[model samples]
Target: MSLYFFARSLVYVIFKPLYRIKITGLEHFPKEGAVLLCSNHIDNFDPPVVGITSPRKVHFMAKAEAFKLPILGKLLPDLGAFPVRRGMSDREALRVGLKILKEGNVLGLFPEGTRSRNGELGQGLSGAGFFALRSDALIVPCAIIGPYKAFRSLKVVYGKPVNIDELRARKASADETTELIMKEIQNLLEKNR
Candidate 1:
């Protein structure tokens, strides 16, 4: 936890000025307890940017490759981040995310699974939706409007939380739930764009 806060503080101080990030809807974040941030991926910097901009500690899921570097691997987990295999069914990543939620901490997910090459929305892979359904955590839908647009200050808007009861009634399985959640998240992103 110390390392997480320390790293978070560093990022908050260092890159925030460089990015000139603008964030709204911070009040939607719960003051305490479990929460999930479901965001659209636009660049490799998204996770760290979101983590730093957030007011609370956020456990972000990163590709396994990033963890291969010994120093980064050791530092990342301590800094409230974890690794998930990119192209495989990584049960471990899912378990880690669930554990974070169970512990009443925030879990950050890029529903699209990776950075967008064309700066457009990618298919949300369902991880965020499945996690939300299983953990009964608040899903905070967020969108980054100008991530790929060069040299421009990026705007990240956090939408209102999705009601879990309403989401569960529409789906019988994790995949279905994921699809619905993605659609909801995508709609917000498109509208804001």
Candidate 2:
């Protein structure tokens, strides 16, 4: 197996027992074609948790700052994480994300852009919508609950894909699409709460 798959397997083996991870809605995931997995950012562990729980391989956009570390910088890319500069428009990152989708791969993102320090869902950014629109990828809203604690049970819920075509036909802007995505995530979180 590739390093990425190996690492993901290791994460699943370790965290599944430690956190008692429970995943739902795997049936909602597309069997093939491009997909955009959007979820709330609770902490650094959010990415790995989502990645491991997902039915498909997920390529995540991590903050460029995280790539500055010597060892981690070299390893993250192998683990399906690409650098994205926060607080500014990073066209290169956007292009990379779009490319991943166009190549028929799953691209994972946190619509909130950054981790929620208080563990509450925050306002989502427009980047997720932008990528969805640009790549014509299905947006799968995901909710991850109780991942902060290593010994506590953690849950991940994957909602049905958002109707992007209908939303676009309604003249929904990127920000509006992002809001819709966040709403779906919130609903999923509430259902599992």
Candidate 3:
């Protein structure tokens, strides 16, 4: 099996029992084709939780520092994650993300750019919007609810795809797309909580 699936299988076994994760709106995910799975960043567990819960493999733009790790660094790429230099423009990372979507693959993004210190949603960054406008891929909003504390009842709610095609037709700016996505995500959070 591919490392992504293998890791997902392992994480599912552990995370499910430890967290009591309750997933909803997975039916919103398309079985195939390129799509963006955008979610809120909470703790270090965010990426793995999003990837493992996704029905399809998720390609993530992980921090460059993570790739420096002795073992995890090597395993990350195999797990469908590429490193991105945070706090600056990383063109290579952008290229990789666009490539994944252009090839009809899933690319997961945390639109807030980084984890929220207070566990509330942060402002959306331009990355997710850039991808939505540049590529002809669906953008699905996801919310990871509840504390990351062990044995807590955590939830993963996948929202419907934001209509990028409609936005594109109107010549939407990347910022505008970002705003729309963030709003959808905020709505999801409010509804679930």
Clashes of 2: 0
Model 3 residue 150 distance off true place after TM-score fit, in angstroms: 2.0
1-193, model 1: which lDDT tens digit per residue? 4987777778778666767778888988888889988887887778777887777888998878878898998788787778898888899999999999999999988888877888877777767778988896888888877753444678787888877786577656766666766776677777776
Candidate whose TM-score is highest: 3
Write the candidate numbers in order of decreasing TM-score: 3, 2, 1
- Flag the better candidate by lDDT, 1 or 2: 2
The TM-score of predicted model 2 comes to 0.96
Question: Which segments of model 2 are wrong by more than 4 Å?
Answer: none
- TM for every model, in the order presented, reads 0.89, 0.96, 0.97
Model 3, 1-193: lDDT tens digits are 8887888999999999899999999999988899988999988899989987888889999899999999999999999999999999999999999999999999999999888999899999999889999998989999999797789899999998888778899888988899999999999999998
Q: Each candidate's lDDT (Cα)? A: 0.80, 0.90, 0.92
* RMSD of each candidate relative to the true structure: 2.0, 1.1, 0.9
Error of 2 at 37 (Å): 0.2
Quantify how close model 2 is to the true structure by its C-alpha RMSD in Å: 1.1
Over 1-193, each residue of candidate 2 has an lDDT whose tens digit, in order, gives 9889999999989989998998999999998899999998887788889989998899999889889999999999999999999899999999999999999999999999888988889999999878877777889999998855768888899999988887777767888888888999999988898
Clashes of 3: 0
